[model samples]
Target: MITTPEHDERMAKMTFASVYPHYLTKVEKKGRSKEELHQVIEWLTGFDDKKLQDLINEKATFETFFQQARLHPNANLITGVICGYRIEDIETPLTRQVRYLDKLVDELAKGRKMEKIIRGQ
Candidate 1:
């Protein structure tokens, strides 16, 4: 895993004019949009203008942007496709809520299993 400091440093050195084409290439590969890219930045940095400017100005690395994007609420669908799982169309608010809730439950179950193993139970 790349450390956050290294990630930030690389991001700081990027120039968008040079990186935009590559960024668009990744977006095409992922079947996402420029809007999604902006949304990911907004989500990751709490919509900080300075941070957004830095990301845009530096031609941020796709790896860093992709990692940040995955933290967005819609990222589960992207991950599903990447992992060879079927992506569900969670268009409705209810469906979205349930999906997130299910993810939360799964995480809790994994935490419980980890705790048991750590405790030698």
Candidate 2:
């Protein structure tokens, strides 16, 4: 549904902003007020001020979280799950046979029939 390049760019910016608050602070620290800092933190974390403070107090690091995000299987599972198909349900013997037949047909159409090519017949 994300149709426009501009929308994708905005999403990328939001993702970067959410992932790196220090980067934003460095860019606008001088003119930014205390309320703006709170707003930025809230926007980044999708949490209220108290929750954000707790997260900070717990010694969370963006680098650590980002590394864990890369390893998370939720996204992988979601792709398969939402697609109305299971990966394991694929790759059956019947599917393999059909693929083999398709390859043979393609070879014959291209005048590279497998038996002649393979046996030098």
Colliding residue pairs in candidate 1 = 14-58, 15-58, 16-59
TM-score of 2: 0.29
lDDT of every predicted structure (CA atoms)? 0.40, 0.34
Candidate 1 backbone overlaps, count: 3
Q: Residue by residue across 3-104, what tens digits does model 2's lDDT show?
A: 246533333233323533543344354444444444433332244666555545655444332322222222122112112334234334222222222232
What lDDT is obtained when candidate 2 is compared to the true structure? 0.34
The 10-residue segment of model 1 with minimum total lDDT is 78-87
TM per candidate comes to: 0.30, 0.29
- Taking the tens digit of each residue's C-alpha lDDT, what string does model 1 give over 44-69? 32435566566667666534434343
| 93 Cα displacement, candidate 1 (Å) | 36
Give the top-scoring candidate (TM-score).
1
